[model samples]
Target: MQTLPVMHDADTEPLDDAVTRRVQARVGTVLRAKWRIDRVLGIGGMAAVYEGTHRNGKRGAIKMLHLELSVDPEARARFLREGYVANNVGHPGAVSVLDDDVAEDGSVFVVMELLEGKTVDALAEQRPTGRLGITEALRLADQLLDTLAAAHDKGIVHRDLKPENLFLTKDGALKVLDFGLARMREMQSNAKMTKTGNAMGTPAFMPPEQALGEWNRVDARSDLWAVGASLFTLMTGRLVHDAPTLNQLLLKAMTQAPAPIRTVLPGLPAEVAEVVDKSLAFDMNARFQDARGMQAGVRKAIAWLDKHGEPQNLVPVASLGTTSPGAVDSQMVTLKRDPTAPMAAPARPSRLAMIALSLGTLVLGGVVAFFVFGGSSGETPEPGPVASSSAGSARVGAPAPSATPSVAPIAPIEPARVAIEDAGAPPPVPSVTASAVKKGPSVKSGADFGEWGK
Candidate 1:
């Protein structure tokens, strides 16, 4: 498995020449008459792993120590040793190495069985709490212990054990990976970073003896300590020990006790928490002395959890990749309309109905006008008493016309005499002068002059 890059400040240092050479291993380059490199998966300081296919069309991982590192006696030895150790491990829980060779370019490469599942760390990131459920975590831990026991039987000590080195296969089998740090014996003085204290394992998960840089003290028991640390992370979703710097980490692992699983997670089964806590004991003698012993404890924990019904809180969303935005329980949201949502469109009026309605409104307005002021009456009805303060009070003469006009008011008429005419003909009015004018009987309101004549 690939390690996380220790990213440095860009301004502080230039990109290493090894990084450029890593990509130089061209894709589709047939190697060893069988394997063809398809692409580079990742590159470390001394090597890179590529995706490749064999003559049988079986795909696998190809790890190649860079030419620059191949020339170095120590790097060359370590890279080759990893392949040998992993090959000899001969356990289904460990990745199997298929072949190894020195390329024409003078770089050494080893092909391993391709694993198609996420790293433990990747699975943890997919989980909301960075862990698996109690039952599953215990099951995985049991698998890891079995692998470690097998490796220990072969006299292999895996110095580096962390979430990144653990893989969950597509079939849900746990696989231990990256034997690069594994060894039958301690590293020679030449590999030390400092003459005094240079640890080989990841700081967060390293055991006390390993953290102290006492390579001789790291053996099967030390690996078991690492297993405990792994269990702590898998169960509690946190590192067994934490610090900001390497020195702080070493100081804590060497001096302070690891926080109990129960302390981080109170509801966790006490039996399970106890087993993980013992594994992380600062004193090597206080921890499980062998892989078998640790494996027994893990089995017991699993049994306890099964009997008690494991905590449901740690079950992660089933995921093959990173969780997407707003996704939960492995379900993706659709932006399309919901089939269950209500539709509320209004009913539209028909064209014929609208036309009929408009015409009916016009006919009704005409009828209203006929009743109000369209009598064709020549006689004037006396006007209603006007309120002096009203804004619409009419002047004595005429009212101004509006869009729908009221009929005009009539002017007061002076009395006049009419000359008599024959029946069936309308009466002719006498021309009135001041001397011939005569008073007629007062007419009641709204009476037509023709009616008065009748």
Candidate 2:
């Protein structure tokens, strides 16, 4: 755990200097006797992944906890828990966590097998319609379910499941990545955004339960819903639960049945439709309960297609097609990311400042109101002189026409405030210290960190 120097925004900085420093320092300490870090591969919520080579020249990926998250005990524990869970599961489709430990600064780090190729999310974007064909989709779904099956049996649930979390190897093997260690940014971001509005799976892929925030109640059946949505997108090149408003989206999810698979992809066999419909059933009880059960339907679909002489396996066709200018190409269609994506980043202090400012402004106004009312209290001021009507005396110009009446003021209600949780205060800046190479603890061999955290 290397500590990072907190630099100001104006500091002309290397985009990843702090992260690089931490990784280099940790590798020096944990694998100093064995490996040297080369470069950062990517950064996520809790970890920065690096490509490294052992002293013996063996290459691997080294993952270290993000400094911000590592300092928090709850976060650190979860980070290690993800690694521990990954270490227990053994499956070809699952990436293996090789080793793990805490750095001197208390950052959690895990080493894993380095993999090549893009994530499923990336592949979906590269394709013409953001989808794979029926055959390819089935195979991928089968692989995903198989991984989920092993985890489900052990009581592990992939609370977060999405394209970005699933990695595809260069060899065309589908391997589940970030099994339980997806960044907190991704997790919190997903939770806040997966409301009653957008479909929970994705704008297009979200299932009903997820859209309704029932994700916690989700079982293996919830994943089946996602699989069904994925397959539908693959075959039809259209989203089934799409609506401009969240309300309409939920309505479609709960009531509207997906169009049969063959309806969109002409020549698709009836068997494929049956399998998809069964899985897409609004009632989970009607859907396959486990991955093995779902696999049976997929196998049947594949066998039928093979026997019918339909394309037994569809190759991923690339060309996100375009028709009208600036119009999203249906084939190359992808949900565009917001310019300022609303991820839950740590900016606790700033939020606190805003709250304090609002409170101070309200208190100041209240003090002013109290003094004004106090002066006007007690005896009411004598009524102004009134004019005599009958007599020309014009006695007292009628109560100088009661100074134009003022509108009644609304009573102010105090706003209920949110108590901000303090992200621990920053630590003292330190002098430059040369990193020492130290070996990390050895993990037990043949210990399977089962899937989903089981």
Candidate 3:
């Protein structure tokens, strides 16, 4: 559970600096005789992350609670509970908590798997546009939704979800980090831990209910809102609500609707924009009812991307680390269309339409057969007219012959050709030339065509 760098208000700078100093001093020291602190990874308001090597030669990240918070029984318990809550998710996307122990100096620390990847926020910053491409953005969102779905199923709600809390590994796997602020639905007794009037989460990513300190109203839907806000930022390089002061930001979050996603990325697909809009709905009931529902919406957006082909601006997440900011990778530029352009309809007909055409062709052939064979009468109908010459040309304004004559059987109609014609495609031209028709057998009567159908 490594925390990323976050800006703090002027009033909290001194405290943050002091905490950082204290945590930095622990470098080169051995904790509990089983783990050795190698260096400080990151420091947050609540804890500091350190690279730790165990006596068994295995390495992991040690997240130690601040000394001041370690003394508070409630804070210590909540900090340790992050391990249990994360494991409860039972998802590979959730970072695994290996162990928990106390330092000699009375600081509590939990060990987590050491991950070799950049946080999503860092990855996005590497892009030239300060945002992710449509394909990569949706890929990360899909994985995030899967993890959230598992967490929600176990009665857990992640009170905080932001780009900084999501890490994309070198191998392209996205891991969810920091269950510190998560609310465990089964632990009703711990409801007192979060004070009724005190809001707890990043202001920019918080939903209206969470920002208003309406803890009773926070549920899986609250997490969905945060995911939407985070995705909005990831795709647009802007906050949902921006303000000069924390108070104003929180105020805006509670009262104002997030600007529609299309306003920032006007080229975005309507289906994708709609998903973000629905998730940000102020009314919880109007939002995706669960993580599964939101996941379904995300999958649909991915399907749209697949049909349209990858956008020209797409930058693969793998290249972001080595590629310099504002630099585009020639190998990764797979531009199929301008992302801002209107979505084009599929080039081919739908499967259902093709199937219907096939059935209609078969039904029509059956009716023609019934009339030609005299409808169960077991008798062949009389022939009408035929071309006497080998050229297969019909006579114009000619009197009907007193006696019918024999004719060559007609070629069978192809079902695929019929389906194409039914779908509004132009009919294919016959390849036979006049000379070829003349060399072929002549048509003596119309009844000869029915022999091919039989």
What is the per-residue lDDT of model 3 for residues 165-225, given as tens digits with 9 covering 90 to 100? Answer: 7777768888887786687877745544343444656667888887766678889999999
Q: Candidate 1: worst 10 consecutive residues by lDDT?
A: 445-454
> Candidates ranked by TM-score, best first?
3, 1, 2
Global CA lDDT of candidate 1, please? 0.60
Which prediction has the highest TM-score against the true structure?
3
lDDT winner between 2 and 3, please give it.
Answer: 3
Q: Which 10 consecutive positions of candidate 2 have the poorest summed lDDT? A: 445-454
How well does each candidate superpose onto the true structure, as a TM-score? 0.63, 0.56, 0.65
Model 3 TM-score, 2 decimals: 0.65
> Which of 2 and 3 is ahead in TM-score?
3
How many clashes does the backbone of model 3 have? Answer: 3
Error of 3 at 142 (Å): 0.4
lDDT of each: 0.60, 0.52, 0.66
Q: Which portions of model 3 show Cα errors greater than 4 Å?
A: 1-12, 15-22, 193-195, 310-454
Q: Compose the digit string of candidate 2's lDDT tens values, residues 66-123.
A: 7777776655665566665665555677677776766556666777777765555455
Clashing pairs in 3: 267-340, 312-335, 407-444
